[model samples]
Target: MAILSASDRDAAAYPIQSLFVPFPLVCFTLALATDIAFWQSGNVMWQNFSAWLLFAGLVFGALAIVAGLMDLLRPRTRPLRPPFLSSLLYLVILSLALANSLVHAGDGWTAVIPYGLALSAVTFFLCLVAAAVSARKYARLAWRI
Candidate 1:
């Protein structure tokens, strides 16, 4: 009946995937901000920051994906359906992050600024949607428990 009963949390790594999900969201949002700032202020520094943020987001997203996979493979006290869907949603967000990083890899600031910013915005929105879906699923699961 509880949200996460003792048995549901087997160890420190229980729900580890959730811990990493926010990292990319934060980084990608900052990347968008820096991209816009670069476009407005003509600051090369902003472009550099955006590049680093994108890279960080990808790295963190990879970690999250790994954790999610591990969770999926392990036995669980809770139903796996909602978490599986959540993991799929996270995978989509990670794919977008990878694509956004590749876009940044093109020619310098001029090539990526506005377009990359738009991509980041789209990715961020998707992340929000994924989070919402995951939250709703978890809430439904909790009520059933």
Candidate 2:
């Protein structure tokens, strides 16, 4: 990090929302991996892991959206905030994760194989797409940026 001169304190500052971006991305991505592990080992433990991860992702993702919105609405920070399209994409990513969490709420193998796993895959894919769309900026799944 560069040493900030007193006059430059206002410069190179990041949005508070950007600081929360990595949590959801890591959580959701790990949830997908745990889903695969559940599929492979048929372990109830993996499913439980996924449940917690999804929940964590939801929590952090919500915080990120709120922070982003706060930044966007602030006159001084508006220009530094993410675009509406970026926020929209983050919402979609969260929606998919919420649906995936619901799917994982089911019982046994059926809970995962066709549906839960599918949802996880879809969510992961959406994250990748959003990241790509944002030119890999930390803002939407842009993996939760």
Task: In model 2, state the lDDT of residue 38.
Answer: 94
- Backbone clash pairs for candidate 1 read none
Write down the TM-score of every candidate: 0.80, 0.82
Each model's total of backbone clashes: 0, 3
Using TM-score as the measure, the top candidate is 2
Per-residue lDDT of model 2, residues 27-144, tens digit only: 9999999999999999899999999999999999999988887777656555466656766778898999999999888889888889889889888888877766655454432355
If candidate 1 were superposed on the true structure by all CA atoms, what would the RMSD be? 4.2
Which whole-number lDDT from 0 to 100 does residue 93 have in model 1? 79
Off by over 4 Å in 1: 1-13, 77-85
In model 2, residue pairs whose N, Cα or C atoms come closer than 3 Å (at least 3 residues apart or on different chains), thus clashing, are: 139-145, 140-145, 141-144
